[model samples]
Target: MNWYRFSDLAIDDDEISMLRRVHIYVCSSKDLEPESAGGTEIGKMLFHLYRQGVRSELGLIRMVTEGEPPPAAEAE
Candidate 1:
């Protein structure tokens, strides 16, 4: 399942900004898993948070850490 670790939630301006610039790369792509089908659960979570509102524009982006280049079909 998709759970948030401390590092996953931390803020690093340089990396964060770089991620926003490439938001489309991650946020636009969707891979439905067994737990949450239909739409991207993470995307839905972010959308919910956006609906709640934030001080600045929050963009969702993803990166490759290990496994496949697209970073899919694995367990964390």
Candidate 2:
């Protein structure tokens, strides 16, 4: 079985720009209206999660695009 990597996709500049925008939006949203109470905390949490997820995805992309892949294991 072959594993798919983000680098395998032919992602265009527009898609990359959109991902960057989403990352920035989530990061900014985490700090927005910190003075507010109630649902503000929940919103921050969600935004934090989003930021983490995006960062993870970006890391994967970087790894696949810029780093050498590990040798694939031989099938049993």
Candidate 3:
């Protein structure tokens, strides 16, 4: 799969708009909680994704398929 970085999306207005919508959806969703283990995992993924400005689709795939723990200091 081709991964899109922030720099690539920065030049495209349409991609930026799509990313904004994905961000809004994540923030507004009530199902994801920070207290639960799964929720915490998702939270960590979001944190890293935000810092790196990863593509929304790629982030979603990673969140579902990997669930890799992020750096403690960064996640906190």
Q: Candidate 1's residue-wise lDDT over 1-76, tens digit each?
A: 9787776566578754644433334444444441344435544554444334321342333222123365456686
lDDT string, candidate 3, 3-70, tens digits: 87777545367764654554444433534444567556655666567556565665654554465443
In model 1, what are the clashing residue pairs, if there are any?
A: none
Quantify all predictions' global Cα lDDT against the true fold. Answer: 0.43, 0.47, 0.54
By lDDT: ranked, best first: 3, 2, 1
Q: TM-score of each candidate?
A: 0.26, 0.33, 0.34
Best by TM-score: 3
Q: Supply every candidate's count of residue pairs whose N, Cα or C atoms clash at under 3 angstroms.
A: 0, 0, 0
Cα deviation of 45 in candidate 2 (Å)? 14
Prediction 1 TM-score vs. true: 0.26
